[model samples]
Target: MVEFAMLVIVGGALVAMVMIYLRGRSGFRVANPESGTLYVTGVSPRPDATGAQYVTITGNLTGPSVPGTVVYGRMAWDVNDWPAIGDLIPVVYPSGKPERWQLSRPGARPGLGS
Candidate 1:
């Protein structure tokens, strides 16, 4: 009877392990990836261990369709790459969502900055 109980416990543990492994194997999810233009309203940099600046940028969009949707996001980069206030920066937003955006230069890669 004890051997039967031990066998059942071992079998249940093996099944649980397989289920957990399969769950974690699910792949990466993609973002909405909509691109647009927005103005930089402000920037504040916080120093990191690598000496790179982690900047929090607030975008002020003043367009006809997207009227005044201010969004704040952070990016890690060299100080030279930081955008100035009132500068019209290339912004990528989530599909059907303007408030979720990332600021970037023209011809640069999208969805890298957060």
Candidate 2:
């Protein structure tokens, strides 16, 4: 009976470890590219953003050279969709630099700043 109990405990521990590992690798944080533009699949308002409404955008790099690159940024948008934690959005870099992950929507009108 003792041996059986030990086996059960060990199995439970192993299962728990696997779950924890998987959860850690779920890819939640937004990875910014070398450019300033942040590629996000979605956007979400920051908890503290009040007047202007700070936002966190999440999206994969859609640029030709860097595909599948996850990106995120903290900024303010005029829209209401409010990207969620896992949404994906496009990004545009002005100088084509990787570190400049700060980007705006592609083909955004001329008045928008870089």
Candidate 3:
């Protein structure tokens, strides 16, 4: 009975690890210049952080114009220069009021200059 229990525990752990790996590897990139929509991978912030989180976006390029290319962009969570990770916030452009962009849990790919 002890051996069987140990085997089951080990197997469960292995399965859990595999699931996590797959989740991390399942992300892809999608971009559309016409609509100005860019889907990035690895943009999710780490758990536990304050304001203005920084995340690195990476993956293959998609959309009408850009295809099979790699790009990067910087997304600022808050107005502060240093934002913490895992902070679900909107990115405020320099345009004007009510002009803001919110990054999804797993943010989009980093665009140019990121």
Which prediction has the highest TM-score against the true structure? Answer: 1
Ranking by TM-score: 1, 2, 3
Clashes of 2: 29
| Candidate 1, number of clashes | 0
| Whole-model alpha-carbon lDDT for candidate 3 | 0.42
TM-score of each: 0.51, 0.38, 0.31
Assess the local accuracy of residue 60 in candidate 2 as a C-alpha lDDT between 0 and 100: 62
Score residue 37 of candidate 3 by CA lDDT: 30
lDDT of 2 by residue, 1-114 (tens): 999999999999999999889877652333443333233456564554444466666666556455555656676554434455443344544344433455445324212212
Tens-place lDDT per residue, model 1, 3-112, is 99999999999999998888766522228565567767787844544545777888765443565688877766565555567667776665656766655353343232
* TM-score of decoy 2: 0.38
Task: Spell out the clash pairs found in candidate 1.
Answer: none
TM-score of 1: 0.51
lDDT of 3 by residue, 1-114 (tens): 999999999999999999888976854223321222334444545536666665554433333443434444554443333233222232222122111223334343323423
Stretches of candidate 2 off by over 4 Å are: 1-51, 85-88, 94-99, 106-114
Clashes of each: 0, 29, 12
